[model samples]
Every structure is written in C-alpha cells, then in structure tokens.
Target: MNMGTRTDSRFMHLADIVKVNLELEQDWTGLAVHKSSPRGDGDCDGQKLLRPLLSGLPPKRLYIHPDDQIDMIKNLTGPGESETEWVLPLHQSENPTTISMLASLFDSLPNPPVPSRRKRIILASVHNDSTVVYYIVHDGLVKPRQN
Candidate 1:
C-alpha cells in the first residue's frame, strides 16, 4: 500500500482480504480469504473464483429463460446433471473506498454470511461507478422450505 493512499478517498483502507487466482486467463483469476484453496471445492464455491470474476462486472444475469426453469425443475433433479460452473463475463471496476467501508461495517458480525442464490445476484444495479456491490441469488422453488 502506498503511504499517500490516505489522501485518496477512493482507496482500499482495510483490504485485508486476499484471493487465490486459479484461472490462468487474463480476464479473471481466483480470490479468497485463505492462502490455499480446498480440494474439490468447485469453481463457484469460494471467493477465489467468484470475487475477481465479479469485482467490476454488472449484476449477474440468467442465461436460461423462464420456460426452461419449468423444464429444469422437472427433469434436472437428483444431481445427475449438475453444472460445473456457470460462467458470466465481466467488465472491471474499482471501488476501494466502498470495499474498505464495507469491511469495517461488517467486522462486527459474528457469523460468516453465506451467499444463497437469492442474496448473491444483483441484476440491474450497474452504474458509472468503478465497482458496484454484488450479491447472490438462488434458483426458485415452487414450495418454500419447511423446517
């Protein structure tokens, strides 16, 4: 970190989070909190792949249409056809200040927040900023979960 970084309001102050770059492709590498990644953890499982891939990109979009949802729900059950990873192309953006601010804000939370499909994807939130915050979203089910 540069000593003069304090002067820049848009710099990463608490950017302690480190990532592992798994992909050799120039467009995207991996990112994670751990120095070493777990085996068979899958591409979409950790920050190692998801973070840098989404850093400056738009809120993720679904490639399949609504009609396919019904088909998938009926036929693609019981894990015979699970996908390896759904690739979404991204454009780079920077938000050092926002990330730093978020780090401080979320530091107090005890539980590590898990990203479900609903909370993960944030479609239509893109603007002229360097990098915007993105969340996860899940596949829709006909009946809600009952415990």
Candidate 2:
C-alpha cells in the first residue's frame, strides 16, 4: 500500500498504544484520551491526534503530521496540565530513523506552550517490530546534567 493509505491506519495503531501505555501509568495517566483529525489534508482522517479530557488539570492538544510532511506541527499540549499531559504524543515507527524525525516534528509545532518556562514534547515512537521508544524533546538547547 502507498504511504498515504498507510498513514491513517498507522495513526490508529499508535493512538491505541498511547491509550494503553497511559493506562498502565507508564509515564502518563489515561484521563480521557482521544484522537483528532489533521488540519490540511483529506488523506489524514484526523483520528491519530489526541487531546486532554478530564485530566483534572486543563485541556491539551496533540498534533500528528503526515508521513511525508515534516514542515508541519507534529504534537501539541495545552497549558494547566503541562506535567500530566507531557507524556502523550505517540509516533508509530517502521525503523530507527523515526527517532530522528522527532526533532523536525517538534520544530514545526504552532505556538507550543512552555510549561514552567521550558518547552518540550513527549515522543512515543513505536517501531514496526512493536518496540517503542519514549523520548522527551525540548524546544531549544538544554544544559547537561551533572550527576
């Protein structure tokens, strides 16, 4: 199947993973999880994106870009529940390069909120083999920790 046809299903797969992962309390809680449609394309059915619901904090939005489209926003989360909503954004990966895409994806977000003066996005990259890698991507430069 072509990439376009595959995109929708991939998002569905990823969303389910995100829901289950959150339910397990891996890093986030499953406080009303659901997907949203992509903004500019009919190809993207808008079911892969997610938003906050009953999180007890505030509302948040999750943006998922197309496979070939990297110049668009990939993820977003509203304020109030910055800490709680930070654990979403799951990307289904077919390979290792998917991890690298996180950088470009995060760069395209539209007016991403800065929680406590820090800008960051959570990436849950699921490989084709069913292995998923989680990452916290910061908006700008980060200082190394001394431990």
Report the C-alpha displacement of residue 141, candidate 2, in angstroms: 0.2
**What lDDT does each candidate get?**
0.28, 0.45
The RMSD (Cα, Å) of candidate 2 is 11.6
lDDT of 1 by residue, 25-54 (tens): 222233222212222334423233212222
Task: Count backbone overlaps in model 1.
Answer: 19
Candidate 1 Cα lDDT to native: 0.28
RMSD to the true structure for each prediction, in A, is 15.7, 11.6
Superposition error at 133 for model 2 (Å) = 2.7
lDDT of 2: 0.45
Error of 1 at 24 (Å): 26
